[model samples]
Target: MVEGIFHVGEALAAGDVAYLVQAPETLISPFGRDLVAAAEANGTPVYPVSAAVMGAIADKDNPQGLLAVAHTRHVALNSLGPASQPWLVALVAPQDPGNVGSILRAIDAVGASGLLLLDGGVDVYHPAAIRAAMGATFHRPVVAASFAEFAGWARAGGYRVYGTSAHGRADYRAAGYTPPLILLMGSERQGLTAEQTALCDELLRLPMRGRATSLNLAMATGIFLYAIHDALDQQGYFAARAS
Candidate 1:
């Protein structure tokens, strides 16, 4: 369970809340009280606890006076964005929860279609990932699939798969980002393997000019996110995500 008020609020807005725990501190805060009222309206049970008890139950170091538990929404590969402009970010076996969360934030920031977690990686709902993601976790379509499943789906969907790698020959800026594509980011410890990279239609690389050989996973993904948006906007191919 997570303790941030806004996070819980987002959960409530999405009708994803199972329940909520309220501490005395929230009684005095306007938004906190609003959430409790919203919870009641939604028929979600609310449990009141002392701050000490809240601290004991919450995962955050400093509890936000509210804790919300919501069922995870398992988005399917076929149910992702529109086939015409299905720009997606796929992370392969990402080990860091914080990185996954930050990448989700980046996805929301750039208005990308969705995120796909391939193979096994940090859960999209891990507390750390949720905390790091703020409330963006509840806003996007997140799916989990095996690498093979994803590859097959991409082919069937006519997607252009672009893998990101340090050794990739094509510069990220120069590469074409046609719609219905996947930007696959490999694990932080071990980037895309040769075989994995081979699955992509092309491999994209960011420039390395400084002593630092690589950029952090979230940072690289953000750079790419913006670049794709800029390119699409310039080409008049950009559209606000369809509801």
Candidate 2:
């Protein structure tokens, strides 16, 4: 379910299957008009409701005039293969929905392949996550799996898993991010478990000079993703994609 004009617009632009859209009678933004037009073009029903009614259905503190109900899209873990240039972000037992959503947004920004949720933390479909993602959730595939199941799949697919840790030997910038790579992050409260870290082909750490000992999950993931993207780009990853 997508709420607010911005999110609804993103869902429509991404070609998500919308079942219905509801808007207040007072909605007059050009963006809202375009959204209504697009929904109607795709044969989706757009219902006009009272502002009070809209408030009851919308989840935001400042509810926008638009809301959309759309189908969830995800692929099974078994469906993943050893495709060329695969770059994936895997979260193990992520604790916060907002963090999950922010991470998804970052993943989209870096043009990574997709996201993998291992052993389940927050529901990917949670409204907070969906809102925080700013429609990125619609832009990429998100898969869920257990640690053991994911480990088996990664092995079979020749994926090099890179786990993050403060005590890691290799600096994040120094690590090699080859194709078919997986950036594995642990939960907020607890970092990667012993078993989880043990499975990684390489353990990486971000340098910290300040008094702060750690970064938030979303921030840390973003830093790692952009760094990996830069490193891969320098190695002709983007050039290969263009060809």
Candidate 3:
């Protein structure tokens, strides 16, 4: 079950919200009432309870007036073929759930095709990750696979795989990022290992111009995702849509 207005609303829009539980006072607001109407239109059950009752169902100090039950949405690796997502970001065994969610949000913000959580990472559905994503998890295609499996898929689909490193010789901006590509980011704890880096078509690094030698996993990944996007834009990659 997902909690909060944003998460529930996204799930409702995705047609997965089965039922809703709301606090009595929320009906006075427009968004709250609209959510109830949407849920009802879909034949979803809406239960109104006192604030005290809501607190019992919620994980937070404040229940935020809503909680919802939604079915899990799974995205298969094959479903994310080249056409489905021209660019993809793969996270390797991310230790922190919030970082995973933030990266997922970044992927959505930059219009990347989807996210790949490689190896055994935090559950995407974990409330912390889902909450941090601010409902982005509901619509984006998220696939979980081992590094080997993901590598094979990328190779078979003819994708250019770029791995990030602290000591990579290639600057990310100079690397010619093409579509049907994957930007592979390392784990929060250990970054990328030698074996993992070898699988990549190229290795890239961000400029450490300041005292800081590294960046937060999500922040670094977001930077790389946008860099690739801007490069594609400069190449007139988005022109076809306007035409």
- Alpha carbon lDDT of each predicted model: 0.84, 0.88, 0.86
Query: Which has the better lDDT: candidate 2, or candidate 3?
Result: 2
List TM-score per model, in order: 0.93, 0.95, 0.94
Model 3 spans > 4 angstroms off: 26-28, 241-243
Which parts of model 1 have CA positions greater than 4 angstroms off? 81-85, 239-243
lDDT of 2 by residue, 7-67 (tens): 8888888777565545556577888888788788878888888888888887886666778
Worst 10 residues of 1 by lDDT: 234-243
Candidate 2, residue 13: the lDDT equals: 82
Question: Clashes in each model (backbone N, CA, C under 3 Å)?
Answer: 0, 0, 0
Query: Which lDDT value does model 3 have at 167?
Result: 86
lDDT of 3 by residue, 1-243 (tens): 788787888888888877898887744667867888878887899988998888887887766788888888777888888876888899999888899889889888887888999998899888889888887888788999998899899999998999999888799989999888999998887888887898898899999989998999989998998899899888887785456
